[model samples]
Target: MATLSEIETWLHDRLPALLAEYEVPGAAVGVSFGGEVIDHAAGVLSKATGVEATADSVFQIGSITKVWTTTLVMQLVDEGKVELDAPLRDYLTEFVLADDAAAAEITVRQLLSHTSGFEGDIFNETGKGDDAVEKYLATLAEVTQLFPPGEMFSYNNAAFTVLGRLIEVLRDKPFDACLREYLFTPLGLKHAATDPYEAILHRAAVGHIRPTPEAEPVPAPVWALNRSMAAAGAMLAMQPRDLLAFAQLHLDSGKAADGTQVLSAASVEAMQEPQVKVPALGLMGDSWGLGWELFDWAGTKVIGHDGGTIGQGAFLRVVPEHGLAVTLLTNGGDLIDLYRTVVGHVVKELAGLELPALPTPPAAPVQVEVDRFLGTYSCEVADVTIRQDEDGKVWLDQTPKGIFAELGAKPEPVELVGRDEQSLIALKPENGFHSPHVFLGDDGTGRALYIHSGRAMRRAPA
Candidate 1:
């Protein structure tokens, strides 16, 4: 591990230029290694306000909040109050789905691992009340199930909302209160908060969205996601430092800095162990753990998660064996590029580890037989259609659903190239990064495309 002075020196020398190269408005980073920590922040928090960023400036850590949610669930497991294998209906009696049989079989483990296989993206506002998650659960009664329970890996935000409700029921308190009492307060995270109302009490960064590649990013139209989706990725806010401190607990076997046991050592290990294989979606992790994404970088195990919300992006990566964790929180601009540059440097410098290289496209592209994947594939918040043109060029038409569609959204057609017999990559013409659109083989049930962050978009009935 690099010394604190060395890490600070590297950040001062390297970060600003990289941020400028990526056009990132602002970013904060935290590195924890060998029981030492260093934090760095750069650029303005918002282009409009011109507020300088600081290490203490809280950015919505987006889906990075999933690990925290899962930590609370594991704490309940430690108390013998919750069982990972038990059906979720065992806890939330009001839980129902369009597919009743599958709903009855979904387990707590599946929810944590994102294998619940239901329509994942439901962003209905349930109002910011104690009953928010309850109302969210009620709305799922009409949502469709994309896969049978535990059948395959599909990123599901709705699953976490369900888990959020379970937490409310099990703790007999609101989700935010339970988070404060069980995780944030116990860990002494002074600035950590679960909703915008609480986050505004701290130095919070506003999200920004760019209209085009050359356009300047402006404040995002939406301030925060619906409270109903809080557990999934709605409202958690914290600085990179506190986020790293939380990761340190996992590295310390669930023991806080003061030697307080927050989660059992066994539960912590289970949370990092590989639970199910994840489809390739340009993510670093090859598999999903209880809540963490498990990555194998040159045969060394790394665990962490990435989060995005309203143009804000956050990444947390932990090298448990090396006692190292690094986080990057940014408000806008080519986030994936910034993450690759910043986080790629941190791992290589501090831990003697190289992050995964971006996947290269095929040397010779092959046209796909569009008919096989031609049907409409639907999920909770989006539908994707595979189409072929007169020249036999295959592509995918992705259309947002629900609230997004109501706001004048339109389908985006991304060109596809065959990576293999069963897999295709949606090539973003500008960057050429390969986002895998793999076809999970039909097994009598139906054919499906694992798109939208590896969520299964099953073909509609013929």
Candidate 2:
């Protein structure tokens, strides 16, 4: 295992590489191991002012807030105030869906596991009243279901919004307040508030967006979603060390820094158990827990989650077996792959184990007949024309530039890393896609049909 000093040096050296490569403003990292935290910060917090990053600089954690929501729900379960499998409508009368029957069958557990089959990003609150949650729930009569309940994992943000509403109803308080009282305060997370924008204005790191390859950066607006959406992505600014404290609590069997048992051991374990299968997300061997993702990293089990805001990214990974937790908070749009890389490197060095690399697609042959795969495959989302290049190498012609970059070069006998009937995986480097690309096609031409947002694509004709 790497020494603490060595790990710190590696972080200092590698973070600049990521910043230079991605052009992000700055990043803060915190790692907890053996009951202590090693916190580090580097680069500029605001590129405009050249303000150096610090460990206390609060960063928006985006969807990493889901863990707090899940923890609150599990706490309610511990108190017998809520049942995981009980229909959510039982607690919130306003809960309903476009499909009345399916909505009635949706359970609390399904929302946390993202298996309610609710459409992702279906609820639009633009121009709505301040009470967006109430307005949206009232409009559920018009909302539609993407799939049936428990059918598969769909990563529905709306479902989590409903979960936040459920929390408000059961607690008789705003969802944010419930999170603060039951989760944040009890855990001694003083620097980890849901609304750090107002709480720590001077020290808060404002999100910035770089519009073009060569353009001035602009401050991104802070999102003001209704508390109903809190479960999906509401929590705000947090210092890296503060986040490490939260991780340590979980590592210490849900005991807070002051040694108070904020959450029962059973509840923590329940949050780590895989409740649903998410094969579509390259997680065939993994499962979605209450609020965490459970997967095998090397031979060790990893329970963690990733988060993204409109212009920021955050990731929290915890290895229970090794009592190690890593948190990365960045104020930029495309830092997820960097977060994963940092985590993998730190874990490898600290635990003396190598993490698994992402699967690579098979290589294309230098020479081969290209007529069998020649066709203009069209899908509902994209049109892909597979043609033979001048070098006789088959390539996916007419592919969107964004999608093509994600797919990389064409390959023969493309391996399916992930698939469903509607989509297929082509080739994705271990780092993952810069922008989401959807795969649309069959196994004959290629499992992937087209490249849409969040999926991979490849050329099949040559």
Candidate 3:
């Protein structure tokens, strides 16, 4: 393992090149091991303002906040105020879905595991107030149930929103206040905030977006997600060190730095226990736990989560056996690429673990009959269509659904080059990144099964 000085030198030298390479506006990184923490920041907070980024500058940590919310729920569990297996309705009596039966049957476990089988991405704008979460839950009555409760595993933002509401109801305060009291304050995370109003009080980074393939990224108009989605990872912003402090609680067996039991060790273990097999198709992690993505990195068990909102992205990973964790919080740019370089280097240097390789295409592209996949496969968030033109080249076209469609999101058309009977990667020029697309099989009823980023989308009926 490299010495601390070596790691610090490497970061200082390498991060600027990465920020430029990825077109990222700015980023902050934190690494913790052996009672020492290394936090660093680079690039400008925004290209427009030219504000230099700092280790103390806050950026939305996105869905990484879900684990924090999960920790809050687990605290309630430690106090016997919530049950993992209990129906969500037991605590959130106001919760109802388009499918009344599903509303009655969905358990807190299912929600935590992303197995609730409900159309999860309900980004309906609930007004900013203490009652925002309550109003959001009421809006669920309009959302269609994607499947019966607990029948399949699909990422569900709405489920976490409900979990956020659960915290508010049980704690008798707003979700933001509850987060501060139950987790942030006890851990002394002064730089962390859960809403835009609070975030404005700090040196928070502005989100950015690349308008086109060749244009420079500009500042995003909307800085935060709809207030209703805050619990599902919309609102929380923090510096990298503050994020590591939160991760430290998990690495320390759920005990705070002051030796207070913030979460029972049993509850912590349960959070790491595998709950559902994620559909990464050989990329990312193999499964999902309560609020964590479980990875088998070089035979070591690593638990972590990645979050994205607007154009910002954040990542948190923990190697508990080594008492090591690494985080990346970025406002924009090629985040996945930045993560692979930074996180990969740190883990290899400190913990002797190599990060997963990015997906690559085979030297010779394979060809297959394209009619088999010539249909639409969809989930709540998006839909993808596979088709073959008269020239006989297969293409995959993907677009947003539900809330995303309502917001007028655009579709990306990728040229699909087959890798096998079951898999392919979007064929781009050598300079472009190749993302894998796999056909999982048939989902019965004569519909083709497809997996993208660990979420299953089946053929949609005409």
Candidate 4:
């Protein structure tokens, strides 16, 4: 195994060059091992101002916030205020969905495990009020139930916001206040920021985006997404070290630095237990626990989650068996490559495991059953249309909607190559990685019922 000193020296010399090579404006990485934390940073926090990134720079952790929200729910569990298997309506009676029957049957476990089966990417603008999160619950009134509740695994951002609202109703505080009082304060986090106001107090990184695939990245038009979706990872910023501190608590079975029992050991263990198998889609983990992504890195159990908001992306991985964790936070530019380069190295040399290699197109394109995938799949955030042309080249075209459009997201179209009968790899790279698409279930007309790229989009009716 590589010594901690050896790892630190290599990262200090290597991070800056990797940022330049990957075209990321700024990034920070924190690693925790043997009860100590080490962090490194490189590049400017924003290309426009050129403020150099530092160890204390705060970057948005995105949907990694889901785990935090989950922790808060588990605290309620530890307090005997919530039951994992109990129907959500039993606690938050105001919780309603378009499918009232399915809504009544949804359990707290399904939400935490992301099997709520409703359209999950609903990021509505609720303004910046303390009631922003509460206002979000009403937006789900017309949300489409993609499947029966707890039927299967589907990534659901909206569900976490629901969980956040549940926390508020039980704790009698806004989501942000609950976070401060419950998790941040007890964990002794110094640089974590829940919104733009707090983030601006620190050296904050602005996300960068390439206007076009071949263009150099520029500063994003907005600093963060709306406050309403905060629990769903719309806007939570912190230095990677602070993030690792939170992870260390989980590694220590939910005991905080001051020895507060923030979560019961049983809840921590349940959070890491596999609850459902994910679809064959390569975009996410092999399966999910309560809130953590479960990965089998060559039979070595690794738990973590990745989050992306606007142009910023965050990756977290914890090896509980090894008592180790690593986080990489970035403001745009080939995030997956940088993550694999940094986290992959730590896991390999330190824990002696290999991250699963990302999918790549075959050298020779193979024929696929394109007819079955030719249709439109609709979701709240975006619509994906798959079609094939005369040369038999298949393509997936995505058009962003709602909050995504406000943040300057544009229509993206990529050619698809056959990866298997049910999945395909994008022939073109976005942000330096090919996106994998998989068709799941049947829509009764021999068409795919859902098109999955992390979040599942149901097939649109003609």
Clashes of each: 0, 12, 1, 0
Off by over 4 Å in 1: 366-368, 406-412, 429-432, 443-453
Instruction: Please provide, for model 3 over 1-462, each residue's C-alpha lDDT reduced to its tens digit, 9 standing for 90 to 100.
Output: 886668888889889989999888899999998999988899998888899999999999998988998999999998999999999989989998888998999999999999988777778887888888888988888777766787767788889999999999998998988888888888988899888888888888998876655667788778888888888999799999899988999998898899988888998899999998865455456788999989998689999999988878899999999899999999988887888889989999999998876667678888755666678877767778888888988788878876556545575677878777667777773123577776656667444555544555656767
User: Cα miss at 123, model 4 (Å)?
Assistant: 0.6
Superposition-based RMSD of candidate 3 using all C-alpha atoms, in angstroms: 2.2
Q: After superposition, how far is residue 340 of candidate 4 from its true place, in Å?
A: 1.0
State in Å the error of residue 160, model 2: 1.1
Cα deviation in Å at residue 298, candidate 1? 1.1
RMSD of each: 2.0, 6.5, 2.2, 1.2
Residue 48 accuracy (lDDT) in model 2: 63
The candidate, 3 or 4, that scores higher on lDDT is 4
Range of the 10 consecutive residues with the lowest summed lDDT in candidate 2:
411-420
Taken over the whole model, the C-alpha lDDT of each candidate is 0.83, 0.66, 0.84, 0.90
Ranking by lDDT: 4, 3, 1, 2
lDDT of 3 at 452: 48
- Comparing 1 with 4 on TM-score, the higher-scoring candidate is 4
Q: Would you give me the overall lDDT of model 1?
A: 0.83
Ranking by TM-score: 4, 1, 3, 2
Overall local distance difference test of candidate 3: 0.84
User: Per-residue lDDT for 91 in model 1?
Assistant: 84
